[model samples]
Target: MNDYKATVAVIGLGGIGGVAAASLCHGGCHEVVACGRRPLDRLRLERPEGEVEVPIRTLTDPQDASPVDWVLLVTKAQDTASAAPWLERLCGPATRVAVMQNGIDHAARVKPFIGEAIVVPTIVYYNGERIAPDHVRIRHIGDNDMLAPDTEDGRAFAALFENVPISVGLSADFTTLAWRKLMINVVVNPITALTRLRQGVLQHTDIRNLTRQILDEAVAVARADGADLKDDEAERMAQFIGGFPEDAGSSMYFDTLAGRPLESRALTGALVEIGSRHGIPTPVNTSLLALTNAVSDANG
Candidate 1:
């Protein structure tokens, strides 16, 4: 039933990219290419209902890849450079690159690699865990698994998932929504990674107060960046953070435990950068950024 309607190349087959590739293949609406550091013959997708095993075509070498209609750049912000080879091969003038990672500067991170291609900044709310290199688990975290700007390409990106279980939404004010998402990341990633704990740490009263401080400063930065956030945005975000599952571990926590460089530079670190640009004082995030950097440097 697959007519190869479109060519979709997914680079960085971690939790997010892996599950996305499997979903697209299961949907059978496009010709999906799973590009990674090594060749893989099959992918196991664990869902709430059951597990699915999909036979997939994976390209471990960049030279074998060609321009595709869509490139889902799912690499961590810090590893964007490592994925340059794959982006160069899979991106063309007609390509639309959907960056499905943390941080706000999605286009700036991936633009240089994709020549004349459109950069689609995306917000992913789904929780995905890479249990193994070939095995991945996905849990939808919100009403929508993904969100894109309400543009023609964003609509098309959403349509690509209409036939699949994962839901994609289009937003007119994607920037504001993106900042909202970043507001969450700035709290969870740093707290979890620094404490070497999971989301449970955020439940502590002291930690909750700390979360407020971080958000107050970060929210100021977000509003300065024109995100339409209110003065009480920090309070709103704290309530939202309280809703996360305690057992859930953040991406940075996992990276810290694995002795890999944390994505702090993108999450908390990005907040600091934006805050500085706006001449706003992000003392809380700035300190966290330094701690996270030390942790990341020790890992590297």
Candidate 2:
């Protein structure tokens, strides 16, 4: 297993980070370094297939870290600032950094600390949760897919996950890709968080109509922002979400329940911000953004 040569630092070992660390370790092709605020000797990932234990060099302090071949910034968008110290130490001139968080314009978000490193924007499609320290529960049985821009660095980033179960591929149009994922997040996250319900709420006729309006608003904003989204994208997403598992919940819902700060700013807030900049109205998303922020403030 030690034969795999590349060194990877997975920052913020939460659900997404845990899944990435586990899959990469399962690939058996790279040395993984788990970075977080707490110390952990190992990471336990519980998938439907079976349980996987990945032993990693966990570091609590940025001082103990050094430059790696790849740095996976898996923190929430709102916490980008907090991960600055880790990025400062883990990135070098040639290091390829992947921003594995939600929202668009990922490269610009981390550009401040990454300096000359190649920044790859990654969009992850999977469901997982960190149930305890060093332990995570894979919420879905489907394959975890990661989509990156079709470029030299993007392909190289995808190569790091070779032999892993997750699907790592490149997209010719990353703008549409990011907007597509954002459409899903904006639709389901706020509703689930506000109603304290899971994705099952979308099954209701009234809720489905509301979801459509939200998606429509977000799609409009995305189009104005230069994404090539289709007219029927909202309709298609509403149908898909309606058929989702009754107990399926979004990260926002989980964060609200856990009393953790919400990433509303990254999800809906981003939509609203860009919509304003482009002179496009995002009334539905703006309202959701306010409600989600209120929930976060309450929790705080």
Candidate 3:
């Protein structure tokens, strides 16, 4: 059996990171060392039902964070470089780092700092937001479903959340899972940001069709990258998009609307790059990427 008393160090106490920290802490699995650039005591969390005050040791610098058995990197994909200093300090010989972020390049993004450390890529399905430095609102906790490569460490990681409210498991085909999530994000995120509408707004025939176009391009890219996805994955993605709350807004939408730096490159930009590699025409994704970049630049 895996030990439940391991220490977990969480870097980047933003929405996803904070919620995961809180959940892990509340589950009593590990002693959480919440590290960020700011004070942890001042960090607050907002839940859909109400606000919960998270009790965690806040470290302003990575050097101050205690080395632990595991480290969960929750920063945006674009912030990988900025988080390098923290990874350098928190990762130890046996530390297994779980990356809970978007994109399919989780391992490639953090390999520079953690080097041979066991890196597990996780697909986070929660909807959360940081309304303030200390306050985060979780719109949907959803299922704690995470897709990681099947290995000894992967099984151990899955065991940590077993019997808890979260569902963690190994994916024999992680590439397909990651690519599937990427395609879903490509279709839903940029469109919501551009239209300034929630997910449900895409129910309109025109919006739904446009979403399909985006998914079609992304699916081509995924197939080119050797992911085993069905040809009908794009249609399923559109159907999934329609199931979210009518007023549900994506993280990218919220970030762009709040004037925060959007993770455009990680989302749409990566799609275009991958599509180019496969010689697949990704005009729809390319257009969305261009539009998102334009909006980001204009806002800046």
Candidate 4:
């Protein structure tokens, strides 16, 4: 069984990271520390029913941090390299690092930074939007806020959020689930970012057609990579996109609007890279990645 009063350290304070810190603080069960470049006194989370406010114990320097039971690496996929300093100081043999970022192969991504610490890869379903440095809004996207592989560490990760609003589900077929989420991500994020529009943009006829090609190519790559995706996964993805709130925007969308570098390399780029290895043609994603990378480079 996992300890209820575990010491949890949260690295990165973006939208996703901010919600995580606030939720853990709201639980009041764990000793939670927020690690980032800047110090935050408190966090206010806008929930569906009400607002949750929690004081944050933030560490602005890696030298001030100690080993913790859990570390939620909530930085963007491109920012993982920058979090290495904190990982070095906060990780011990017994530490479990939960990676809550885009893309797959989470273990492999963090292996170089963490020596022997266990990696808990997760599929985040909650839509967390940072309104300000210390304020965020959480929109429950689906039944579960996150999904992890059904294992000891996964269960312990779930237990950590037991009293929080975020719900973590476990599944034996995590690979398939990750691919399923990837399909939706590749479509919504890129299309929205490129157009500077919201989820409502998915309703356009042109966007629908473009997303179809993107999903078709991504699913092919997923199948080649050993994911047990269904024949109609693209159609299912379209259905899900049709249900998204029109006013809602994706992380990439907001990033583009804010002139921040896009995470295209992680979302669209990952699929294209795998497609090359499998000898599968991902023309659609390649084109999208190229365009998005151009935008990301302009911002960088």
Candidate 5:
């Protein structure tokens, strides 16, 4: 018999967290313990495939946690500090912690709390929303893949989702892959939040042109930072954003609507900072970052 069974702890029971926890349970090869702001009895994952409810062992206190084989940090990029206490309790020497968040600096964000080598940077492309405290609705439009760096830990992390509906794979050029994804985030998230519209807002020609400008700057920065991106990557990302449902909203937009702190620093602000380091002017992203920060500060 195959003898490998992973013990997993999923911190951050938001939309992405719920999906990750449900997928782990659906795989049936792991024992999952969930940690969130509050405890949940079970998780309801409504996927395009079907709906599956999985009972979860939930904990709200870090002291109640134990070390596990894997730790899936699924919080927004800005909430990494709030999630660190749980990481301290749940991460053992041999434990691999996968940061499933936005932007390109996943390892940089969590490496101080966990060791550098043990932090597996990951990117998840599926759209999901938490409709209830214990329920999440996953929207499957085109791709629902999780990309990780090509490493031993990355392979082991991908292996955890073998039979699950989610696709997990390694990126040979992870830096480029991560930057490419960040370029999309730079264009789509802040604009949607600022406009108070869904993904379909990009369908407007003016907004689409603005998005292309933002993405072009990000692509230039990524290339300077050693990411192998195409010259027309901006247009391609704009086309991809057009593919989302009309009512589909990003996590940043949802957070803004819910009056929570927006993740502008992690998304647009990071772009500006990196662009400056490379001596590239990112005017569009810089303006978006300032506007997003102003709105978030006023609301939050």
Candidate 6:
């Protein structure tokens, strides 16, 4: 086991952040600090087995946040700017910031605040929902791992999750993994949001075909970006989504239905932009991005 004791601060106590903070605290390796828009005492977490009242220090303002060895950002990509102040306050010389949100542009997003500190890009896979102001329902305890490129700080961050159920591994080709996840997101998220349906609803023949098209476009974009993704990867992703519970709703779908701001730019929009840069046509993704943006604007 690695012998490193570092303070951890998790910004944005949403589904992913709250669970990560609790897991880190439960591991007894690091001092986990939970920070959010509201005060920490006001937060609560609802798990499948029972409700957990987090005891860590909670701060509503970034200025009130204490410096730590690592900062995990779990907020929506669009909310990165709002969390900047907290990031600045929580980061020290040796601190490392991990972006646990969606999308492939993790490093680029936080480069402004953390110039020297390691900005680790991580892809989180867990099915969780915020049931209340301080309560989150963890639907699935799927692999809670993070893949980082080979680096000293990346190795250190991986060691932190070693004892815990969360797996952290080093990936020489991190971009491919990220793009693969993005393709999976592209296939399932928009359709679920548009239809107000769950994962299993896409099992219909027509819906499945549409999902395949989206995945194909995303795969093309990934290839153009120098990420080697197989043609059948899209079908495999669709099959994975088909295996989920019939009533399971993705975070993107939930956000769309609730009239909250969606991660349009981070999800489908990013694919379209990258595809254009490589002169690769991504009509399906481009169309979906446009539609989602329109829906978000209409809802707003």
lDDT of 6: 0.78
Better of 1 and 6 by TM-score: 1
Residue 203 Cα positional deviation in candidate 5, in Å, after optimal superposition = 2.2
| Model 1, span 1-300: residue lDDT tens | 224378999998899999999989987888999999988988999998689989889999999999999999888889999999999988889999999998898988888888899998899989888889999999987899999999998987887787889999899999899999998998999999989999999999999999999999888888898898877788988998998889988888999999999888888888899899989999989999999999999998
Q: Is candidate 1 or candidate 5 better by lDDT?
A: 1
Which pairs of residues collide in model 3? 43-134, 44-134, 44-135, 45-136, 46-136, 46-137
**Model 3 misplacement above 4 A:** 42-54, 137-144
Give the Cα error of residue 67 in candidate 5, in Å.
Answer: 1.7
- Each candidate's number of clashing pairs is 0, 0, 6, 0, 0, 1
Best by lDDT: 4
Candidate 4 residue 25 C-alpha distance from true site, Å = 1.2
Q: Mind giving the per-residue lDDT tens digits that candidate 4 earns over 1-300?
A: 345699999999878999999999998999999999998999999998799788999999999999999999999998898999999999999999999998976888898998889999999999888898999999897899999999999999999998887999999989889988888889989999999999999999888889889988988999999899889988888878788889988888988998999889988998999899999999989999999999999998
- Candidates sorted by TM-score, best first: 1, 4, 5, 2, 6, 3
The residue ranges of model 1 lying beyond 4 angstroms of the native Cα positions read 1-4
Candidate 1 to native Cα RMSD, angstroms: 1.6
Among residues 3 or more apart in sequence or in different chains, the pairs in candidate 5 whose N, CA or C atoms overlap within 3 Å are none
Q: What lDDT would each prediction earn against the true structure?
A: 0.90, 0.86, 0.78, 0.91, 0.85, 0.78
Error of 5 at 85 (Å): 1.0
Summarize candidate 6's per-residue lDDT along 26-109 as a digit string, tens digits: 677887778877765534656555666656677777767767889998999888988888888888777899898889888888
Taking all chains together, each candidate's TM-score versus the true structure is: 0.97, 0.94, 0.89, 0.96, 0.94, 0.90
The model with the greater lDDT, 3 or 5, is: 5
Best by TM-score: 1
Native RMSD of candidate 2 (Å): 2.1
